[model samples]
Target: MIGQISEASPEAPYLAANLYLDPAVISALLIEMSDMREPPLDTGFRISKADPELLDVWRRLIGLLDRPDEVPVMAHHFEHELMFRLLQGPQGALLRQIAGTDSRLSNVRRAMRWIREHFAEHLSIEVMATIAGMSVSVFHRHFKAVTSLAPLQYQKHVRLTEARRRLVSEHDAAATVGFSVGYESASQFSREYKRLFGASPRRDADMVQTIVDPGP
Candidate 1:
């Protein structure tokens, strides 16, 4: 059974509606939501009022979800189309900037790509700016505009994500994973990781394992 919506507030009429969302569909939606340019609204819904195009997309998405067998592939296509439509909206200026040549957005995206590819290595904004063919100030502005985070923050996120992956797959010591992800000191890594993820690495890894393989 689908979950209930709490209230009949004017803010969200659809809140009471029964919407059957597949796990894969929910995951794809979450991923796309995270990468969207717009800041989140009050409620979980995408926009204040649903656009016809977006509703159509959602309908198709729900249709795909109804067929459990085809969900994986259909979810991918739905997410792609949803993202494409979102990028066509006003907030998608960041995407357009990145696509256009000689734009600061393009340079920031280049720097971001480089950082993502080499996240395990030590990184400096100066070096990244050079790679992007821009000055430090210009790179910082555009990068923040596109991602709502500074370069260092972005690097830290990449490192934390990689560390979490390594912790789960390799079952290495938290410190070891930290060092592998470019931290020189394990203590510093632990502190930062805890701050970002709200738990110590060991606890987080154990939680992940439990979620992945819940015993009957």
Candidate 2:
């Protein structure tokens, strides 16, 4: 996103709205929204304005934040209304497939969940492809298309993120953190951790600890 912006261009304001929906609720809402059994596929990010009605619904939702007492009473109504507005919008067809059991998007989402759950263990791309119900070549293409990273690369990123998060809570033992995060070689872990974090694990941990737990 930063790379897409011009370095010399003036900064512009943007509103980022994040919708958090429960998986069960999402499945129920999405499946019911579709007229057929299978939900349609949707691509990744695109820029667009919100529907005028959705924009109004969104404003109503945001308005609740200021009325703390009304939130418990009215949050669900606003939320469902917002969802209703989105379902009638331009991306409605794409959003409907989110609940499909056998769509490519569903398959890739399952594969991603598997990776997050078993990030500490060694995994095979072939096995991952099987989990997604796609052949190796096909899975590779779709996985890259969806995540912009190959399966192994995705695993590497997940492992590193876990390692970094755990390091903040654990003592400053880089090798121990490395082994805990599934790295076979301590030296290789340090090298890769350094490559990703721009500093050795021990150094990065100490720097973070210093900032987060600064002395009086």
Candidate 3:
């Protein structure tokens, strides 16, 4: 099962919901979906105008959340249908372009992947450009186009997300986690972390833990 709910407008507090269901199980459906061939173009999935039918389906799906255990199942179905519709829609051109070519967008994606996988180490635009098979200037242009963030900014986001995750699971100090994520200066790490998350590491960690394991 899958669904979506939309507020009346950007500022509305209440939402109208819709739901959808398919006979196939989510995992099996995903496998079959992965096997389907795609067109060779740069169309990304986008919904230009809202569809009432789709909105109705999404509302019904939201009704199923009364059972928490079924949330994952419903979410999978919702994503599958949403993606399918988007791919079949007009904006799918951007998606197709990225999918079909060894274009700059592809290079940006490659660089992003490498940065995510190796964020614990020092990152240089030169090294990233080499991985993307482009000159530094070209790489920067493409990277900015695809992500709207510079390489270093993207790296900081990755590092911060990872550091926050680690802070929740590991018993290490904030400085230790900062250094492990490639920051040599603890104070710099603290400052950046606060800037991004709007709170210091220790405070952020406490909030995350409270959310993860709440008390009565």
The candidate that wins on lDDT is 2
Residues 94-140 of candidate 1 have per-residue lDDT tens digits of 33343345566556667888998999888898998898897899777
Provide the RMSD of all predictions against the true structure, rounded to 1 decimal: 10.3, 5.7, 8.3
List model 2 lDDT by residue over 97-201, tens digit each.
554566687788799999989988999999999999999998888788777789888888888878877888878588988999899999999999898889988
Cα lDDT of all candidates, in order? 0.71, 0.76, 0.70
**Over all chains combined, what TM-score does candidate 3 have?**
0.64
Q: Provide the lDDT at 147 for model 3.
A: 69
- Candidate whose TM-score is highest: 2
What's the best-to-worst order under TM-score? 2, 3, 1
Which whole-number lDDT from 0 to 100 does residue 128 have in model 3? 95
Q: Global CA lDDT of candidate 2, please?
A: 0.76
TM-score, every prediction: 0.63, 0.73, 0.64
Segments in model 1 whose C-alpha atoms lie over 4 Å from true places: 1-50, 58-88
